[model samples]
Target: MVIFKPKRRVCKGKEVRFEITELDPFIWLQVNSESHVSYSIDGFIIDSQKKINGIFNKYEYELGTTLDVLFETLTQTFSQEIYACASFASILNTEYRIFIWPKDFPENFNIQDKLIISIKPVIKDKSIDLSSYKLVNMSALESGIKKLRGYSFSNVKSLLSANSNVECFLANNTGNPWPGDLDALIYLKSENKTIALIEFKTHNKNTPISDEYIGKYGKQDWRRFEVLYNLQNQLELAQNHKPKIFYVVWGTKDFDNHKMIKIDIISNNKVESTNYLDRPAFGESSMELFNLLLKLC
Candidate 1:
């Protein structure tokens, strides 16, 4: 095994280091816990180099698929652990790549509390060249989305529609662009063949739930619910399936706990909101969220 130590950098005026280990099937890259306080590294090894290489070569340039494969591989390898964290893969050389996660790094150490490392690989020499390293913060909404990638959702579609011609959403008008995009639009393969529209939001723990936040549709300029209702109609008509629309808002500080709000279209012009009481405080983990979504279907 060959080990390489990346350069130390000052995070929040304190030095931090990351060590990279070249293992047989997968690369082990983790933070040097000694330099930072309250930091720990989790280790899991991939056994088959051939399988790793096959996955790397197949989805080398596709970040989403690469991440999905990483999640699938980890879940299969470790049955006792949940890897619902932000992680990215980097191509070290022609034959090897590294997947890294800054799990539980100190909050004040970095601006966004997330670490970024860029590598330049020399294929001929088979060595990794570190070009830059920095710390940035990942938004709560984005982190939630990243966590969702760990689960296997059938026929998953994000803000962008599957049809290139339809653009971002089916309800979007060519003359007037939709206010915002749905966080996720997923097709659940159940007896009913359900479709779900999910919207994610990040709020402070102290933020009170108000009409402004709930966002009444068909009232003033708050058309998110209205647009979602329109989308629900379009999808139901197009696919001949039941469409369920809901929004999840999580506290920035306490992300594991979130509130689910269900939206109902009372009529062609009216939309109403109701608490998703089935699971009031949901999302202890990504798997839990996935299970809850399946139950909702």
Candidate 2:
């Protein structure tokens, strides 16, 4: 919610410093790598730790367990040897702390002091206060990851150019928590310099509009609608760029007027939905899917 000015740290062409402090149940680190590595580490668990002999240790937490879930996310996000880690061992005890100095850093890993890394304040409950955190780590919500429906907002930008020659991607790292992402942002490389904001959805099955689909009291389709509304607002609030368009891209088993009729009712005619039967999994089919997105744009 706040943009702190970058404090320039002269690395002097040398390795910069980063640290992960022991904050009990959660580990906190400042992102000072500037535009290069700071954004990459935003929602990552350092992935592994280095032994004194410089060997990387793999996480052996039980599969599908909470620890395993966190580690799996780390594997997907980064391939670096940042040595930033969140281990069950640390949660069980208070001994492990991360302090990255130049001599101890990975070779050829560039570091800069100009980057501003904001550390979130720890709550008494030992859980992260998502609002206080600058970066929105979808992995932080182990269960909610499924709610993303295996969609990647990044590919919208990447695929469009390859398929349709229109440039698009995440506007900027808002650092907002889960459900606080700008689903799709596209750039039209014309003289006007226009951008588009898109909301994408994918469902296994299309349930009819009723209490089963639109209730706050229990499992309902309205929950997804609510998240879309929040993401829309987040994009509008954070984006200062002008000449923007809003769109909704849906991939579902059933794409009929009956299903969308209810969606329009819930969206209050504020959003537009484009339905497709061949919805690709997250990070896949950037070429074809984004080609369709270009038409919608």
Candidate 3:
């Protein structure tokens, strides 16, 4: 009996280094943990340079779609004109095409772009040759928005403390919505304005923006932008309510290498703060969230 040999693929089951074909038309490109995986866009690129306009790479998704599936876990938002949005939107829209180089790169590596890729790890680049790589799809976006991608709780505390008001709140009563066990909620408060809600997320096991957060908070509609859906409900409870800012604080143990993300929401053209708290996990970067509550509270 003759046995047939299996053909080997180029990027088989490994993290493949790649770049976008162009910075325009398509503003953002990301990498995944494994090679040969379809990469996706979490948020569209902003094109800070205004090189190619017409909302390149910034397409809206259907609410229940898989790309938003990760955000559904949020069960998180509130009153404020400042809508929560993907902090990376600006980065994604950058003019500079970004790419992932192998963890090991020669110091002589040179890269630059009119626009910058805000969140980058060991790998960095400017000229992304998309013709050589594949388009990043949904799964890749999830990997890019990894739990460790945001700012640390402590760093968020410091940044906002210096630039904004803050409130350290714990449930006076039991059964707090936030996981008080982690003391994870850091409310940025200034007088009546509730600046934002910061949650420190650092476990190696990343949480889905939709699934994890909703599950984290009793599986309510915690989808990041989906929280805007609750605004009417919250406003009906009162009135004159606006969107709240939210940040998923991420860290790596030491206070360095922190990233804060503006949780995406639908409404208002700006970013505001949120109302939340949680316990700290080691190796977390400060997640920067915004909200209009800061003006009120």
Using all chains and alpha carbons, the TM-scores for the candidates as numbered come to 0.32, 0.27, 0.20
Writing each residue's lDDT as its tens digit, candidate 3 over 55-164 gives 11112222223313312321121111111121112222322122222111111222221111121211113111223223343224323333222211322211111000
Local distance difference test, per candidate?
0.30, 0.26, 0.23
Ranking by TM-score: 1, 2, 3
lDDT of 1 by residue, 1-297 (tens): 011212212323222232221111011111122221110112111222311110110011122334345434533532111111111011111122122323222222342444322122222232223222232333331332223223223333333221111122212222211123234434332222335555544444454333324443335434445655654564465457656665554343333332332233233443444444222332222334444544554
- Decide which is better by lDDT, 1 or 2: 1
Poorest 10 consecutive residues of model 1 by lDDT?
51-60
Compose the digit string of candidate 2's lDDT tens values, residues 1-297. Answer: 011111212222323233211111001111222211111111211111211111111111222244234434433433222222122112112112111112211123233231111222222342322123222221232222222223334422112111000011121221211222233334332221223444333233345322222333444534444444533343344333332333332323344422431221124333344233343343333344444444544
Find the candidate with the highest TM-score and give its number: 1
Off by over 4 Å in 3: 1-200, 203-233, 255-297
**Model 2 regions more than 4 Å off:** 1-220, 241-283
Residue 280, candidate 2: how far off, in angstroms? 4.6
**RMSD of each candidate relative to the true structure:** 18.3, 21.1, 21.3
Residue pair clashes in candidate 2 = 9-113, 9-114, 31-117, 46-84, 134-175, 157-168, 213-221
